[model samples]
Target: MKLEIAQSTPTAASIAMLVQEHYGLSEVVESEFLRRSFNQVYRLGLTDGRSLVARLSAERPRGAPNLQFEAAALEHWAEAGCRVSRCVPTAGGEIAIEVPLPEGPRALMLFEHLPGEFTGDTALDIEAFARGLAVLHTAGESYAGPESAYRLDLDYLLQRPLQGLLRAPTMTAELRPQFEELGERLQAAILALGELSQVLCHGDAHGSNNFIQIDAQARREAVFFDFDEAGPGCLAYELAVYPWNLHPRTVDGVLSDKAAQQWRHFISAYREARPVPDADLAAIPRFMAARQFWLLGEYAGRIPVWGSQAMPTDYLRRQVTMLRKWETLELPL
Candidate 1:
C-alpha cells in the first residue's frame, strides 16, 4: 500500500542501523554513500573485512513486487551465464527490509559486491551487452514469474509521461503544444512500428550499471548489475539507449561521422545474436524522442525530493534542446 511520503534523504547512519538490525550485519568498519539516482547506494565495510552494497530505494512508493521482480530477474540472468548482483535476504525471512521513507515505507535490499569497476573503453564490453541483451530477451520470453510492478510499455514510457509534463506547473503554454504534437507524432510512429519485437529490457543499460571483470585467464567479462528497472519493452527502444546515453558527449554531432561510427559498432555486435528489423531501425528516432520526454516526466515526478534546483525550472527547455539534437540523428546506425 502507498502512503504519503515526505521529501527526505535517508542518512548513512540510519541505513547502517537498518542493516545491523534487520539484516544481522553488525560491526560496520566503514560506511559511505556511493551515489543517489533511483536508489541511494552505500558501500558498507564490516569487521570481517567483507564489503556489501546497500540500496535505500525510496525513490518511488514501491513495495514487494519491485524487490521480488528484481530478485527473480537477477536470478534468471545469473543462471543464463551473465554476472549479476544476487539479492541478500533479511535475517527474519525477508528478501527486503522495510525502511520508512518520509512519505512511506520502502523496501531495502542488500547485494553482494561485485568486483571491478566500469571501464572507459567498452569495445569488448559493448559486445557483451549486445549478446547478453539478446540472451535476456530470449529468457524473458519464457519467464513464468509473477506479474512485475515495472513495465516499459508505451503507456509507461510515453503516454503517462506525456500527461505528467502537461500537468506539471513547470510546463509553459508555448512548450505545451509542441510537446503534445511531438508526443502525438512519436505515438503514431510507435503504432506504425507495427509488431516490433518485445521482451524484458534492462531499462537502464548505460556504462555505470555494469562492471569489467578480468578472470585469471585474462579474459574480460562484462557483468551487468542493477535490475531495478528491468521490464518488458520494445527491442528497438531498448537498443536505442546505448547511443542515447553516448549522445551528450557527442564531439562532432549526433549524426556526424564520428557519432555514427561509434554507434554502428554496438548495432553490428547486436546483430550477431538477433538482428534488428528494417522497420525497427526506422523507428529509432521516435523511441529516442520518447526516452527524452519520458525522462522529463520522470524528473517532474521526482520534483519533491530532487527540488527545483536539482530538477531545475528550465528542465523543459533543456529537454527541448535534447530532443532537437536527437532529431538530427540519422536512422541508419
Candidate 2:
C-alpha cells in the first residue's frame, strides 16, 4: 500500500537543484527552509551574496488560480510604482512553476528577496506601514488581472470561519451557542452598515507582512510581500487588520492609549495618501471582530494537517476571551 502523506517538506538540496534547473540560478550557494505554515518558504542565496525567496503553496482550496491572481496583481502593482516584492519568472518565462508533491501538485514561485526588517509598533514605523498599504490600495484601482477565485467577503470572512470553528473537535460544547450568537451578531452588524468601499485589499496587511527600510536621511520605506490572500475586499477590512492584530499584544487585553494613538497615526498617514469615508472608518471595529473569526476558522480548518497541538484547547479559549473583550472595547476610530 502506498503511504498517504498530508504534507511534505522538500529537502533544501532538492530545492537548490530545482531552482538552478528551473530558475537558471547557477550560483545558488545556499538553500534553507525558512518556514512551513500555510505554505512552505525557502531562502536561496546566490554566490554574489544576493538572496531570493521561494514559496511553495500548500494544498489549499483556491489552488493554482489563486497563485495566478497573485502573480498578475504583483506584476500590475510593481508596474504602477508600488513598492512591492516582485516575482521572478522561470527560465521559460512562466511566473509560477507547478511541482508534484506527496500531498498534491503545489505551485512554486520565486521572488526578489526584500532586504529590510519587519515594522514595529513605533509611530514612525506604523505610519510608514500604513502609507505603504494605502499606496497598494490606490495602485490596485486599475487592476485588470484575472478574476480571483475568492473574495474577502462575508461568506469567506464570517460564515466559513464559523463553520470551521463549530466543526472542530477541540471546540468546547458550551461555547458552541456563544460562537453561533457572535457570528450572527457580527453578520447582522456589518450588513446594517450598508455598502462599504471595495478595493484590491492586501488581505493580510498586518505589520509583519512587509519589511521596513530607513535611509540615511531618516526616510522610511516599506516593501510588501505575501500576496497569497490578496483580492477584492472591503476597504474597512483591509485597514482593520492592523488594529485588530494590535489588540492581542496589549497587557490588559484592551487597546492601550499608546496603541490607540498609534492606530490614529496609521489612519492619518493612510488618509494623507488616499481618501477614506466616515462610514468606512466607523465599520472598522466590526471588521476587527470579523478578523478574529477568520483566524479561528483558518486554524480550525488546518487542524488536520497542523495537528491538535497547534490549536490546543487553551488557545481556543484565549481567542474566545479576546473576541469577547473586543465586543466591549472602544477603538480610536
Candidate 3:
C-alpha cells in the first residue's frame, strides 16, 4: 500500500536545480531553507553577490490561478513604482512554475530580494512604513488584473474562521458559544456600516512585512514584501492589521501608551500620502476583530499539516480572552 503524504519539504539541492533550470540563474551558489509557515521559503545566493527569494506555496484551494493573481498584482504594483518584491519570470515567461511533489503541486515563484531592515520603534520608521502601505493601497486601486480567488470579505475573515474554531477539538464547549456570539456581533456591526472604500489590501500589513531604509535625503522609506495574504478588501480592514499587532494580550483591550503613540504616528503619516475617510477610520477597530477571527481560522485550518502543537488549547483560550477584551475597548481612531 502506498503511504499517504500530507506535505513534503523539497530539498535545497532540488530548489537550486529548479532555479538554475527555470530562471537561467547559473550562478546560484547556495539555496537555504528560510522558514515555513503556510508556505515554504528559500533564500538563494548568487555568484554575482546578489540574492533572490523563492517561495513554494502550499497546496492552496485556489491552486495555480491564485498564484497567478498574486504574480499579476506584484507586476502591476512594480510597474506603478511601488517598492514591492518583483516576481522574476521563468525562462518560458511564466510567473510561477507548477512543481509536483509528494503531497501535491506547489507553485514556485522567485523574487528579487529587497534590501532594508524591518520597521523599528522610532516614529520615523513607523511613519515611513505607514506611508508605504498607503502608497500600496493607492497603486492597487488601479489593478485591472484577474480577480483573486480569495477576498478579504466577511465570509473569509469572520464566518470561516469562526466555523473552524467551532470544529477544533481543543475548543471547549464554553468557548464555542462565545466565539459564535462574538462572530455574530462582529458581522452585524460590519454590515451596519454599509459600503466602504475597497482596495487591493496587503492583507498582512502588520509592519513586520515591510522594510525601512533611509534614502539620499535622509528620509526613511519602506519597501514591502510577503504579500501572501494580499487581496481586494476594505481599506479599514487593511489599516486595522497594524493596530491588531500592537494590541496587547490584556483583559481590558486598551492600547498601551507605546501602541497608541505608534498608531497615531502611523495614521498621521498614512494620511499624508492618501486620504482615509472618517467612516473608514472609525471602522478600523471592528475590522481588527475580524482580523483576529481570520487568524484563528488560518491556524485551525493548518492543523492537519502543522499539527495540534501549533494551536494548543491554552492559546485558543488566550485568543478568546483577547477577543472579549477587544469588545470592551472604546477605541476612537
Candidate 4:
C-alpha cells in the first residue's frame, strides 16, 4: 500500500466515508466481529463482491501511532510469495490512516483476511511450523524497523522468583526453604548461562500467540502473530519457552520430563531448519528457568486465576511446580 496524504484521523463517520470512497460501495451492510484487544477489528461486507476489515483503535493518542512496520512486514512477505495476509491500499492509496485518539492519534490499516485457526491444543504441526519460522527468522534479517535486543535477563529473572510462591496459602514451610534453595541455584545458573548466550529472539513464542488452521482439504497451515514482544533476547531463551508454554494449562508449571519431551521434539525440528550452536544448547536449561521465574514474578502476584474463565487452576499449580523443577535442572554450560 502506498502512503497518501493523511486524513483527519478516522471517526465512525470518517470510516464509513473511507470505506465507501475506497471500495466504491454505498454502505457497510454487515460486519462480522473479529477480535477485541488494544484495537477493535471487524470484517466489513460490502455491496460489491469484495470484503475488507475495519480497524478501530482504542481512542488513545499515540497508543497505536502507525501500522507502517506491520504493513512493511506483511507486504514484504506477500511480495516474496509467502503465505500471509496481503495489505490492501485504501482508495486514496494509503495503507494506514491516523484515527483521532484522546491523547493524540492512533493508526489503522486494513489487511486481506488470511485463512487459519488456532494451532490446536496438542500435536500441532510444530515441525512444519518451525520450517515457516526458519523462513521468517532468516528472511527477517533484512528488516530495519524495530531493533531486537535481549529484554529478559538475569536481573529480570531474580526480581520476580518469589512472586507466585508468596501467593499460595498452601505454600508449605518445606516449600519456603525449597524456594530459597531454588533462588540461590537459579542465581548461580543465570550468571553462568548469561556468560554464554545472547541473540535476536522472539521475546514471546508461546503457542497461544500462533494461529493454526486447515485449508479445504484438511492440510494444516501456521501463522504467528502478535509481534509486540519481539525484541532482543537469547534465542535459546526464546526457544525454551515453546514446550513449557504449549501446555494447555500449567498444573505445577514446572519443567518436567514430560515438558522436556515436547522441547526435544520441537527443538529437534527447529534444529533441522536452523542448527543451534552447542554453546547455546548448553545454556538453555538455565534460560528456561529464568523464563519461568520471570512469568511467576510478573503475574502470580497481580493477576487472579479464579473465575476469570481464563486458564484453569491446575495450570497455574503446574507452572509453580515447573519453576521449582527448573531451579534444580543444571545447565550444560
Candidate 5:
C-alpha cells in the first residue's frame, strides 16, 4: 500500500512566521531540521542567545492522550522537580497548536532547550538511565491532574497492532499465521503472568529520548523527554523498552551477548532504585515481543501519512527472526 506521498515540512519562512505569530519567539535566527519519523523536530536558535526545540507532529501515533493531557503531565513533572522536556506554552496558555496544512491540520509544539548533551556513539550507563526511569515511575504516583484514557496495555500494545498487520496488503500470507499465533501466544503469556506491577511510565525512555546533564559539581544526571507516549503501563514493560531501542545498533540473527549484558545491568539498576515485582521480571521477554509487534503495526498504520518509506520490505520478516531469537535470550534477573 504505497501511497506515493511523503509528508513535507513547511518552509523555514513559514515556520518563523508561525512561531512569531503564535508564541512570540520573534528572534528566530535559525531553524535546522533534526528528524522526522513520528514528528518533525527542529533546533530553533534565537537572536536572544536562546535555543528551543519545536516539534511539528506528523500525527500518526494515534489513540494516546491529547495535547492538553500531555501538557498537564509535563507541568506535573516540572512542578515535582523531575527533569523532563519542558514545554513552551502559547499566549493562551496552551502547549499544542495546530497549523493549517494542505493535507489538513498538523499539530505543533515547542520545548525549552534542555541543558545537556546526549551520548552520541558513547556507551550509555544503562544503570543510570534505569534509575531515571524509576524516578519517572515514582513521580507519576503523585499526579493529580486528569488521567488519560490511554495506557500501555494489550489494546494499545498487542491487539491494535495485530489488527494493523491484518490490514497491511504486503503482509505475507506465510507470515500471517505466524503473527497470529505469536499474538495469541503473547496474549496468553501476558495473562498467565496474572497482574503486573502498574504505574505511569515514560512510554518511550530509549536513549535518544533522554539526555545527560553535568551540574556545576560535575555530577552527571539523566533527564527524560518525549512524553508524547507517556501513560499507565507495567513496570516490566517499561523496563523491557530499553532493548528495543538498543536493537538497531546490536541486532543480528540473535540478540548479542553485549546487548544482553546491558539489558541485565539496566534491570538490576531499576531493581536497586525501586522494587520490581517478580512477576514483572518474568514478563519482560513477552513484553519485548509485544513491543516488536506493536512497532510493526505502527509502521504499517502510518502508511497513509508516510507511505512505503515507513516499513522496509524485509521489516516484518526481520521481526519474525527476532522473535525466534527471543526464545534463547538469557537474562541475569
Candidate 6:
C-alpha cells in the first residue's frame, strides 16, 4: 500500500452533500479552520446552529474499518460527560461512512465538535490533562475491543521495529550507520524486557491531540481528542510519550535535558490522577530509551522525504545526539 500522507484540503461545498446525506442535516458549510495532521479535519456547520467535525481520510478504503471502535469509544465517553467529540450516528446507529476514492473507498466519520481551545506546547494544563486521561483509561475498562489480546503484546514493536527507512533520496552515507545501529539496539532492548504491564491507553496521548476548555473566569479543564490510536497497550508505553509530546523543547529535536525536566511534571500530574504501579515505575528509563529508539527508527524510515528538509535534519541530528546523552542519565528506575 502506497501511503501518501494526506495534505489535500477539502472545501465546504464538496463535503456539504456528504454531511447532509449521512447526518440528515438541513444545511452544512465547510469549516474555517482545518487541522493538518495524519488526516485532515474540517469544521462542519449546520443550519440548526450546531457544529460537527468531518474527518477525511487521505488514502483509499476511505477509512480504516477498525476506526468504528473509536466511534464506539467516543459514544461511550460522551455519554459519561467526558466532553469528547460525539460521533454522529446514522439513523440506523452507524457512525462511519465509506467514501470512494481513486485507490479505493476511504472511511469518513463525523463527530459533534466540543467547544474548547487546543492545548499545544504552551498553556497546557498538565494536571487537568492527566486527570482526563485517567478518566479515559478507566472508561469501559472491561470492554476489550478487537485489540484486547494484543494490548500489551510486543508484536508491533517486535515486527515493526521501524518504518519509512529509505524514503529520502539524499540521505548521507554516514547517517545510514546510525540508523541501522539504532534499529538493532531498539529491537534488542524491547525483546529483553519480558511481558509488559497491560492497560487501556489513549495510544497517542500527547498535548496536540487534546483540547482545553477555559471558563469565563479563565479556569481550565482538559478533554482528549483523536482516539484513532486508542486501544489496550502497556501502561508504561503510553506514559513514555509524555517527554516528547508535551515538551516543546523536545519538539525542536530530541533533547535529554529537556525530556528529563518534562517527565517530572508529567509524571507527577499523572500520578496524582492515577498512581503508576511500582513495576512500571521501575521500568521508566527502559521505556524512555525504547521510546527514543522507536522515534529515531521511525524518522530513519522517513529520511528520504524528511531528510530533504532542514527541520527534519536538525531534528534527526538532535535525536541521534540525545539518545547518546540519555545513556549516561542513570535514571533512578
Winning model by lDDT: 2
Model 2 Cα lDDT, one tens digit per residue, 1-333:
998888888987788788888886658989999998888999999998889999988765333448778888999999999988888999988988888888777788899898889988788898899899988998999999898889999998999889888888888888788888888977888898889999999899889899999999999988899988899999999999998987763225767788888899899999998999988988899899998898888778677789877777777777666666666555775
Q: Each candidate's lDDT (Cα)?
A: 0.73, 0.85, 0.85, 0.57, 0.76, 0.60
Candidate 5, position 184, lDDT:
89
- Number of the candidate with higher lDDT, 1 or 3: 3
lDDT string for model 5 (1-333, tens) is 644334667876577667877886667888777777777777888899988888887756455335776778888988888888878988787777888876667888988878667633333456667777888888889898877768789888889888887678667888888888878878887899899999888887766788887779866678877887888888877877887666552237445667767777777777888998889888887787788877878788788766665665577677676676764454555
Residue range 1-333, candidate 3, lDDT tens digits: 988887899987799888888886658898899998888999999998999999998854223336778888998999999999988899888888888898877789899899999999899999999999988988898999978989888888899778887887788888888789989988888888778899999889899898998889898889989888889989999999998888875555578888888988998999998998888887898999898898888777777788877878888778777887776454544
Query: How many residue pairs clash (N, CA or C atoms closer than 3 angstroms) in each of the candidate models, in the order given?
Result: 4, 0, 0, 20, 0, 13
Put down candidate 4 lDDT per residue, 136-189, tens digits, no spaces: 655555666543332455554554446554555545565566566766777776
Tens digits of per-residue lDDT for model 6, 233-261:
77877776665453333423444564555
The TM-score-based order of candidates, best leading, equals 3, 2, 5, 1, 6, 4
Each candidate: RMSD = 3.4, 2.0, 1.8, 8.4, 3.0, 4.7
Better of 1 and 6 by lDDT: 1
TM-score of 3: 0.94
Cα distance off (Å), candidate 3, residue 113 = 0.5
Give each model a TM-score: 0.88, 0.94, 0.94, 0.61, 0.90, 0.77
Model 1 misplacement above 4 A: 1-5, 24-27, 61-65, 249-258, 311-315, 321-328
